[model samples]
Target chain A: MSVIKTFGKYRNLLGELVKKDIKLKYRNSYLGVIWTMLEPLLTMLVLTLVFSELLGKGTKDFPVYILTGRLLFSFYSNGTKAALKAVRNNAGMIKKVYVPKYMYPLASVLSGYVIFLISLVVLAVVAVVRGVYPTLQLFWIVVPLAQILLLTLGSGMLLSTMAVFFRDIEYLWGVALMLLMYTCAIFYKIDSVITGTNGWIFKYNPLYAIIVNFRNAVFGQAPDFQSMFYATAFGAVLMLFGTFVFYKQQDKFILYL
Target chain B: MSEMSAVTVQDLGVKFHLSEQKVDNLKEYVIRILKHQMRYKEFWALREVSFDIKKGERVAILGLNGAGKSTLLKVIAGVLKATEGKVTRSGVLVPLLELGAGFDQQYTGAENIYLYGAMLGYPKAFLREKFDEIVAFSELGEFIDVPVKNYSSGMRARLGFSIATLVEPEILILDEVLSVGDVKFRKKSENRIKEMFRQETTVLFVSHNLAQVRSLCTRALWLEKGRLVEDGPVEVVTEHFEKATTK
Candidate 1:
């Protein structure tokens, strides 16, 4: 009952913020929402074409593999990066008017989620065209998707809070994300590069864990339950930490911002 | 005291830390911070200030520049956290610290009404029902469809004032936003605000215009250098404030 009441009160505010964010992004552009889908599809096409000979040899249905990893990585990266600017960009409103500050980051992340959802349409189309037929296990995609969503929200909140105080966290995070891209195994199979004890690194990389399981579901194969569980746990912990840091530091934001 | 008072502030203080050397970007800030080059000085904007507003009281805050008047209102509005002390309030409060603070310049005036209304916590359904009323009140007719960036300053202020005052909140905090629009529109806004006064809405207003303050408010609090100097009837406090500042 309390949860429902709280949601009832803030739901409209949240919806309005998200609407404003989405509209603002696509405003004044002719292509508008089409660009959200087009950009990733084009990226998948180019990467698949360029790297198919070099990196695609070890992976089956290489374009789908690259697209899946690329889409999820871009979603997480873009959401948190936008969130880094959320608090500072709204400094005008924050200084003059009062609303829940976290709403800015929440809306930013949710808007990126909207773009990510649009790009998923491209992913589905590619998977089907590549002859990777769907199965009942494809419903299992929801679990890893949920994990990514949680992780994105958590990262957004954490980055936004620190970005407010340091101003440098954004630049630092940019470099970190680029490093993350190579480690996430978007271009090649983990088995091709690492073996034995060294394989634990890829297993522990949360994105690799989620992406591998996601590919398994799409291919009608059973998921790696242990990897799936580890990824979920990793996302859950980060989300909790992000929420805790954001709330604790929010009151001081007016001073720093 | 407890039953009739709408707001109570006890020894409220707000301190802002001003760093002398500015680094707008994070890269420089990180480098400076790592080298222990970051330095900040504490500036107490409001120091141990206290006040109370009774239910249905229209009180004006009078002060010179840098006297912590806006800081006091901001603290009460929950925009700024108090460095020390507490604020207690009993009713739904709305603070118009800066008119159209969140309006998107790229959006049409019509779209901004919904955006502004939503920022003030009005649902879209409520705004949709009052859409005609707000546009008519703003007197922006055909121009409402154009982007807000093209509108004159007065027109933008009119749109903001119209949407904000459309809903009657229990307590209104006005930070010199009423002195907006042309003389004709100012008169119209004065009349609209008068309606709220008739309804006995508790108001905390900040303004330098003595005539407006005396006309609209019953009591006044004069702040000097972040400290409360006097609290009395509006006429008496304004008279004192005038002579002291002018001398």
Candidate 2:
């Protein structure tokens, strides 16, 4: 009921913001929103070709494995990257108007999620063509997907807050995302690369946990509940921390921005 | 949402710390922090300023540039945080601090109307009902569908003014916005503001134009170097400010 009340208050503003973001991304481009599908599809194809012989030795469904991990990571990266610029990009509006500060980051994350959801259609088609048929367990995909969304939202808020005060966050976050992508086990199996004491690195990566569970659900297996719990708990904690920091710091943002 | 006073300010102050060296990014900030190279000056933009506007009163803020006129409006509009003291508002407030604050250059005038309205917290349904009126008043006609980047500044101001004034707000905060556009639109907007005054809307306006302030507001507040210098009838304060400045 409270959620509904909040949504009722901001739905129009949020809708307009999301629409502006999506439209701006595709504006004047020939392909427009079709680029969302093409981008991932091409990346999946290239990675599948380049690494199939090299890293696909142990994995039964290499393309699906890579696609699943890549999409989720892309989802997270895009949301946070956009959010890092959200406050700075709207400095003009923030200085003049009094809308909730969270709306800018919220719109950025939602727009990325919208494109990520659309790209899933391409993932589904490619998986079926590669003989990884849809299974009943696919219905449970929402669990990890929801976790990824929360993580993205939390990450976005934190980044937006920092980015307003420190302009370097934009570039620093790019480097961080690259490291995150490599560590997320997108192109390799965890057992092959993560060995000995370093095993906890992959095991503790909240994104890795979410991606692995998402991969399981896609492979027609019930998701690993422990990983799901870990990722959800991680995302929930970040969400709380992010909200707290964002609200506390937002009032001072105009001064810094 | 109180009824007694539209806005109440007490001992408000805003201090900005102006750093000597610019920290352009996080790397520089971290380096400076680690090296203990950070230094800044405390610049007080507003100091011990206090004022109150009762419901249905039209008040104008007059001062020279950097007199904290815009700073005062921003603090009252809730866009800027006060470093000390407080401001309280009881009614719905709409601020026209800057024309086209959220307008996108690539977006059509019509699209910007919706976007700007949404930014102001109005739902699309409300904008839809007033969409035609906004367009007609702006006289933007076929240009409404054209990207705002191509429009002149006056056209953009027209669109912004139209949307902000579409619905009468309980409290209207205007900061040098009425002087926008050409003479005809200026007169039109001045008349529209007069209509709002007739409707008994509380108005807190900031302007350097003495004639406009004298004609539009019954009371005036004067600021000098971040301090409130005078607050009284419009004629008295404006006359005193004019005499002081000319001397």
- Off-target runs (Cα >4 Å) in candidate 2 are A1-7, A53-60, B1-3
Candidate with the greatest lDDT versus the true structure:
2
What is the CAPRI rating of model 2's predicted complex? medium
lDDT for residue B200 in candidate 2, whole number 0-100: 86
Error of 1 at B149 (Å): 2.0
**Global lDDT of each candidate:** 0.87, 0.89
DockQ score of the complex predicted as candidate 1: 0.61
lDDT of 1 at B42: 83
Please state the CAPRI-style docking class of candidate 1: medium
By DockQ, the best candidate is 2
lDDT string for model 2 (A39-139, tens) is 98888878887787655563447888888999999999989999889989999889998778899999999999999999999889878877898799998
Q: What is the TM-score of chain B alone in each candidate?
A: 0.95, 0.96
